[model samples]
Target chain A: MNQILVVDDDRELRTTLVEVLEQEGLQAVMARSADDALERLQQETFDLILLDLVMPGTDGMTAIPLIRRQAPRTRIIVMTAYASVQNAVQSLQQGADDYIVKPFKIDGLMLTVRLNLQKARFCEETEAADLDKIFNGLANGLRRQTLQLLSRQGQMRFMDLVRALEIEDHTKVNFHLKTLREAGFIDQTSDKFYQLTTNGQRAATCLSYICKSLEASAQARPPIVP
Target chain B: MNQILVVDDDRELRTTLVEVLEQEGLQAVMARSADDALERLQQETFDLILLDLVMPGTDGMTAIPLIRRQAPRTRIIVMTAYASVQNAVQSLQQGADDYIVKPFKIDGLMLTVRLNLQKARFCEETEAADLDKIFNGLANGLRRQTLQLLSRQGQMRFMDLVRALEIEDHTKVNFHLKTLREAGFIDQTSDKFYQLTTNGQRAATCLSYICKSLEASAQARPPIVP
Candidate 1:
């Protein structure tokens, strides 16, 4: 038996999905609000989660990472009526397994749901294989250094940032910072002060420790799992 | 050598793409107008065609079947800024090999082109696999038929349509239509007129045809591909 959590503010849409998923022999849980959805996540695990983007508060974007933490094994599929390439790409970047546009076929929807599930069946095996690999260590080295410095210093000024890094060009440093900000790893204040946000700090603290300790193991990694 | 034709009214994008694809070692060709593209098609056989949906004169939807019939071996990939599941599914049904949402990563664009090319590579070894087999078959069933009929007819009155199809209840058909319209397949003018437009027709036609043929083929040894 599979459990699917559907979180959408639209009562009719949410309820309809519950009925549909139920017909498919999956225990479909409906959450009319993101807060309620998060509460459900804390209580039990789901096989898959269907999240709606336009919600009142703690919208899909904010909820994604938390859901990733709570139900690390569950595949998350984001649904949005206001579909854009930027949004789709961003959702995929945020670790969503797949996305379904609002106006979709019963067949296309079912196909995506089925494909996600089938893909999930073998995901962990491949994920484990990739998690055992190296190569990206050198690629992410500068970003890690930025994170580490931020964690140790609490906050860093824009001008001081450029001087400390080996890179001389301010433009290159700014590019890296922009990438970090976009990826939700760091934040910049109005004063041009760069610091980790609550979520960013938490992730950084945990990830930094893991990477630091696993530096040698990182070097010995094999080919990644696609 | 695989000849890749890029069709777009935008000179800048077309120029950039030709440079990019040629740099990647592909036999790239560009057409500013549908007429020009047809002319190019006559002079040479391309392995792939990249089309822009919103264009002056004949757009992607209008050009699809023409290209499909003219060069059955050629794969078409549609590009659009507006990314909808409806369009994605429709383009697939229209014998389009794939789609790339606009303002996309150059990498994503290249990867999709390469991936489709790679898949078509096997089509040479296997003679029977037509675009219909690879794109749309019986994946959606009645829903595809509903979309196709609506697309081809341009518009139909709801009550009259239900009677024509001999559906028992009006609400069920209406609900399904709402979903289809939302998916961008069908558009209703005022309360009475429903039209198929380009996006709607593409997805509806081929999918509907493939499904009916499959059903018809079930009793036979196998469905013959033509």
Candidate 2:
């Protein structure tokens, strides 16, 4: 179960939030102030923090950097009143990942909590060395294209890739193929066809997202003459 | 020269910012309040707006969506007192692109202004349909790889691309090549060599940035077991 720390001065709100979180199968802990939250941080690790901004003695804003320092990977979500919605944005700039307004509906709060937890898990699972290899593997355009091709075709023979890529330099293609094989993005099947590995498929998905964003950004641009 | 609108109830700060922007060769206009700023926006289009959050009427936060609706492409940079630095982030979330706290150095302010103007120009110059073509041209992995290959090689013959891409089927390569040509990303020389067009080069640069970001994001991911 995911561990969550709720830092709020209001006992009633804190209790309500903790109950809501527990009902959702999360392990929720309460802290009455920023100082209390810091104390808890030293004692245990938390996956996420729901920090109230206006708590007395070491206010939420002041405690953000401190909490971040002590638990660098913990996801902090600031809780602000509706009138201070702008403060939520400020909290984000100060390093909070997301925010919830006071009088928030249970559904919205739970959704935000779940989303951050999912992101936290992804961050935890990703390794620096694995990322380095993934970067080096996809660094070359040919290699990226190879991954994309395999994603689409599922499997392709050496000659098929050669034709699809249209490179006259067979040795150059072979070199890139070897590089990808070493990076674990692709492997030769029993039938001598190239296909994406599980990791390779993940990389391909990331690539697709990148491409779609590129397209979206492009489409989102205002007309040149406008 | 880029047109800039400075909106603030404080006459002294507005005058100073206007002078600074003018010194940097930007055309600066002034508005006394959010209402005044909206009125100016109606009369003339601006490339950028420097807005102050705490005014007598219609605060900056409330004005953001209104200003955005009136001048969708104009970049808004909220100006806040040093104590309300968090409000800057709130401003950003509310639709402002960037922010600067009061008592900021002139150099930093100029830098921010120039950067926003540059971005505004980019948005102004980008057309929706052009982006569509760029997306379509780069949709396929083979097509994107072909662009990358040409980017590295500068120019290549059809057979050269065939060899470099390692594909045995020439027609598939030919089809993609034609598509890229029609999309205005590449062109064939009289000598039968292919090279990226100016737009294609831009697309290549965009692709390079995307790849680097992917690498960076991968590297930035926290360890799964952490």
Candidate 3:
């Protein structure tokens, strides 16, 4: 489970935030002060830290560098009741991933938290050149359709896949299948049944999820009847 | 609610499919044959249709064109037990969005359904040049971060956003903000506070969701220990 550290001086707010984070299926730990947060950070790594800008001692600004030094990969989201241009600028420069004004809606806060964690993970995963291979495999519509077909069927033979894909060019289908196999997204059995590898399954799932979200977003917008 | 019509001669499979679709938060209606499916199309408009290929009467292949003529917008997925290269090609030529081999995993089926719906909706929403505008607005990391910030905070003042963004160059901040506003992603109040427009919020949400899904995919893969 992804762990988050929530640091705030107000006991009530801290408790509420922790509860909400836990409800969202993340492990939440609380710290009453920046000093406490820093101490906790030294003990274990956290995926993210929700830090309050104006704590009692060692304000969020002061603790930013300390937390970065302790867990460089941990993303920080700074919250401030007295939100200002200067503070926002300072926080971002201080290595904070984002800043939220106090009195934020819970839904908005959750979105921020989720997005930051994703951004951090994306950076980590793409730190190498493997992303290039993944992109190459997904570059063509035919290959993507192939992934979609395999994702549904679990495993299939080459001829059936070509038929299901409805594309008549046999050589094109062969080329795309070879590319996917070389990218480590698929494996062909001795009997000639092709199935997605673990990486392929994850990639296909992500692609489907993204497409769904984009559609939902578009639907949520009011239709512009021209 | 998105409504789907499932047509299959196999009563048990149709029931299982309806149950699964309902479980996934969609309204599913069933039909016994291609004739029955066409009747349902005339009675009610559906977002999607799942057609079985090789049914007893008015088989799937014969019904594809009739169904498309009746409801051109409704995306169709053709399912077949004897999936072949010819069947796949014929299905696409007949206007099917995708096809799945019979005996598919329920999870894979759901993914296909979700992706096709998304693809259909995306095409509808992007029928004009609006998509290019949205992409242009999202082209810059700084602009995307700006959207992320606004999405979380609801609104912010000019200088505060600059501070939060941690960029020292005023001209750059001004440029990105102008780009967003012109692209219809944001609005500026008379008081100089900036907030995302409805479209902006939807786009931002979609971006966050996609990023999160991609990260999840990356995490699911075996770690490449460097």
Candidate 4:
């Protein structure tokens, strides 16, 4: 069963969401605060998180990063009563997969939850096959151009990247390498040589890739100052 | 005739480009320096520019901003004999619509020139309709998230954006806004409302907006203590 984590300070709502998720044919765990959520996330693997944005002591917005760090691959959805567009857009930027307005209907909420989870699964499979380029889409468009360079060249050398892509000193490239390696999306055979971690080179769905390209580019950073 | 300006220190290639454009039944003007190009740009309107990247002064990389400042609508393409992928990418980041390696086949070069000019036309038209959103797309994903809040709400109103987007304070928003405005992609109204300028919103074709957005976020200074 796909594992779901429900994080809310509301005891009653947490219980209700858990019961509902269990009936939906998945394993669900509840955390009462962001700290608790982090604790649970460290020990458990979750496919999705149903988070409350306004929770007391480590709210969804603040805790989402913790959740992300703990389970870097998990999908998170923020559920909150204060449903401004800013909240919706910001939470998504903060790594929440989707947001639900408070006082939502069970049918719509369930549908949203199910669809998000399904998308997450599809994305995971897609990422493993494509090397997380798809996940980069959900996160925001980053690394696609570098991937484009790698795809075209078969591989990128250290000096070429430093000279061509960024004006920063080479020290910055080292930082980017560490980040890419830590993320587990890229593999470095040695210093100064890098490729698309296998999955990045695969040619796949054009539309999804294009859409994700927009997002990935949007989310990308220059690996490191180098 | 579609008028073009050629800016290069190489006397022979500059003359050849002008000859080719004229033979193609388009008007092309030649300049041996970036200063000459800037002066011509200020005095006369041109449809496009053929810029060299490695002249003694005001190279294509440095000249791009000056050209744009002088004639915001003029399309430009950077030319270089030496192909440095990093230089090409940096030129794109700096706002040249397209580039050509030295010893370009006139046919291929003309095709790209045509395509970029057409694209520029289409972009100009699009920007007239919605620049704020378009410019936001040019920024890195994190900054874009904050910019989206500013764009969607029409007025940032400070508190809502901070809480809704989960940002800490007023300074961060302004910092991103300053970059947006400085790039000439955005403008703040008399009442201090930030909006995207026409070119700022629609000028991005090579996905530089993602980098712009990320840079601001990564460079975001911490909130000041009162």
Candidate 5:
């Protein structure tokens, strides 16, 4: 069962929300204020947080970053009065995943909660796999160079890549080519030209960013003290 | 010229830092505290922010999210005393991009600032191009279904794809195939099979996540009351 934290100052509302959540088979926890929510966040892991925007102390907007820092993976949903729909939008800009207005119907709130939770789960599942593939594909210098070359040239023949990469051994070039092909960063055209797959293009873009940062750092290095 | 904001409680330190940054060809603005920094953030856009972790009111750690919310693209580097190295790390967790120890060398600070600015520029340049390509490629239903089909089947022939997609018109399938190929999502094999490029696979994964969220939202919708 997914764990949820409900942070609101109104005792009656909190009780009602918790009862509704529990009946829906979700594990629900409550906090009377943002401070209380932060404390609980530090001690426990939650799948989602329902935050009230106008808590007495450490209002929801201020608490967002603190809460996010403690639970980076957890989803946050800000609850605000109907009149403060603007604050709800601001809350999203400030890192809250979604928002619900006060006097929200139980069904409407549940729909929003379920949608955000589903998104969270989806992100968690795909992020790791995608990151692993991208990082692993770019780990080698030759691989990185190949991606850059393909990105610039659009496509190349096998021998062309070998010449561009300046690797003497054909087998060595072939080995890296196989690796790239397997990693899904590069593909061969029907006529035998080598080119970046869509992911390869994205990886190449990332590589350029990394190169720029490294170059900036290298250029900015100061002379060592004698 | 890149704009920078320097947030510090100490007037002397703030002035010195701004002078150094100005000398390096960056436009620098000063804030006396986190509250002051937030006010400036609201008024002007910045390429980077140099934040002091400790201040009298609304310290740097708390200011990070607020600053980020205001200027989502700005790079933030936290400044802290040597004794508070841990807080610098915490600042990063709270969304600061980098941190530097105070009572520090001018050369070091310049290096950090330049590196972060380079990264920020790189992100801005690549994010738009990549997102446009991804969104455009996924905009059509046929294109989306084609990606899903390729993702599951690994590779398919032209006729095979037509049959699998359950489309009687080969011309329609061919049109969509050309679209996907141009979008860098698919490649044709030497043996005449069609397969997703690495980027295509990533797109498929994203497509799956989007589908799951839509499905969840649809299921959670309340029944229409007459």
Candidate 6:
């Protein structure tokens, strides 16, 4: 469920907005001022904060960065009166995602909330998909070995790799090679040789470096007494 | 031509390697020591650096980060002898891209150089392609204005944007919207309304923020009297 925190000093307006947000099928929480909002934020994670600009203490503008620091991914929409729209626009510069003027229709406020949530979801999903491919490619021991061999030898013919790996089954090696190629870690040349692509080389280099460190640390450790 | 820096204290080996690299159509510059390499780096850019691990002063391992800071994109391949391959491997963690042991075949070294250069080219080309699409999308005033409107209003119908933009020619607005949608900046809803996609929203927010800063800066500037 989408979670929202509505922060305003005006008690009646705050309650009405929270009621309307809840009616729209969102989980809405309310705080009376920025200080109360910050305290509430510590207790719960919110997807969005509907912040009122001019509060008696710790105004919305001052709390914007504080809230962002506490929850980097939490989106904020500052609420300003018509006369304070300029200051609210300034809050956007300070990291507020968007703003809404007071006297905003409940429908307009709801639309903004939905759109921001959708945008965050879309970005997270896309990034996760890309990372999934890269991580899956690196997860296999055989694939990492294949990449390491390529990293050391620069490029290798299929038969050369099969012999170098001392693997009797060429088909198993071929399958691993195919997986690496598809994962964008390696590529085949026109002359039928396989070599690490940029991302592949980077991954291979990092893995090799890590292995080196692990071996060094292991060798440096004192052996157990018999 | 590809530029390579061969940094080694051994005059005979450095000369022989530079000759081989140049014969292979690479522009190879010889640096007798790490200090010499750093000086040459300030004068010219290189695609790759062949660094010798042991030198009279300022060895290859110490030069790795310095070279990286000087030319962040330049790939480094540390050269170590058989006994120091372990130390050379540790250099990878220190920022070396890859390492080659001494008494290495000239062919093997050349292949490593070619592969690293090719990987760099592929990465650059791929990133440039993606950036081209984004830059092309943001190049137009009309498209930026459309994004600004969506940023402020959350979502808009085709006619709503046309009316808001006050553009008499509906076809012009249509063309801009198509471009934005194709570039993945915006998407169409099931109800035929237009809204910013995840990337689109982020881009719009950044553009809006930049516009605000620019306007503020302009206002801050003192006007010149004729």
- Native contacts kept, each candidate: 0.02, 0.05, 0.14, 0.00, 0.00, 0.00
Q: Which stretches of candidate 2 lie over 4 Å from their true place?
A: A82-86, A132-226, B1-226
Deviating ranges (above 4 Å) for candidate 4: A132-226, B1-226
TM-score of each: 0.36, 0.41, 0.40, 0.35, 0.43, 0.33
Residue-by-residue lDDT tens digits, candidate 4, A38-71: 8775556788888999977877798875565445
Please give the range of 10 consecutive residues that has the lowest summed lDDT in model 1 chain B.
B208-217
TM-score of chain A of each: 0.56, 0.61, 0.57, 0.61, 0.68, 0.57
Q: Each candidate's iRMS in angstroms?
A: 23.6, 13.1, 16.4, 19.7, 14.4, 21.6
In candidate 3, what are the lDDT values of residues A70-183, reduced to their tens digit?
555578888989875446645654546578888999999998788777767675555334434554565566777788678756689989998998979878899999889988
True contacts kept of 6: 0.00
Per-candidate DockQ values are 0.02, 0.04, 0.08, 0.02, 0.02, 0.02
Which scores better on TM-score, 3 or 6?
A: 3
CAPRI-wise, candidate 6 is incorrect
**What ranking of all candidate models by TM-score puts the best one first?**
5, 2, 3, 1, 4, 6
**Which pairs clash (backbone N, Cα, C closer than 3 Å) in model 5?**
A199-B199
**In DockQ terms, which candidate is top?**
3
> Candidate 6 on A75-172: residue-level lDDT in tens?
78888774332354346535676777778888888877876665444434433343345446655666766776776566889999999888999999
Q: Write the per-residue lDDT of candidate 3 for residues B1-226, one digit (tens) a residue.
A: 7789999999999999999999888889999999998887766888889999998989899898677655655788899888754466557545566778888999889987887676666755553345345545655668877887786566899988999999999789999999899889999889989999977865675454344434534434543221
Pairs of residues at least 3 apart in sequence or in different chains that clash in candidate 1: A133-A222, A134-A221, B154-B195, B155-B194
After superposition, the stretches of candidate 3 with alpha carbons farther than 4 Å from their true spots are A1-211, A215-226, B1-123, B126-129, B219-226
CAPRI band for model 5 = incorrect
Better of 1 and 3 by DockQ: 3
lDDT by residue for model 5 over B1-226, one digit each (tens)? 7889999999999999999988877889899999998887666778889998889999778888667545555788888884342354345435566767777899989887887777676556644455445556666667867887777566889998898789999999999889889989899899999999866765665553333222222333443211
In model 4 chain A, the worst 10-residue window by lDDT is: A204-213
Better of 2 and 5 by TM-score: 5
Supply candidate 1's per-residue lDDT for A112: 68
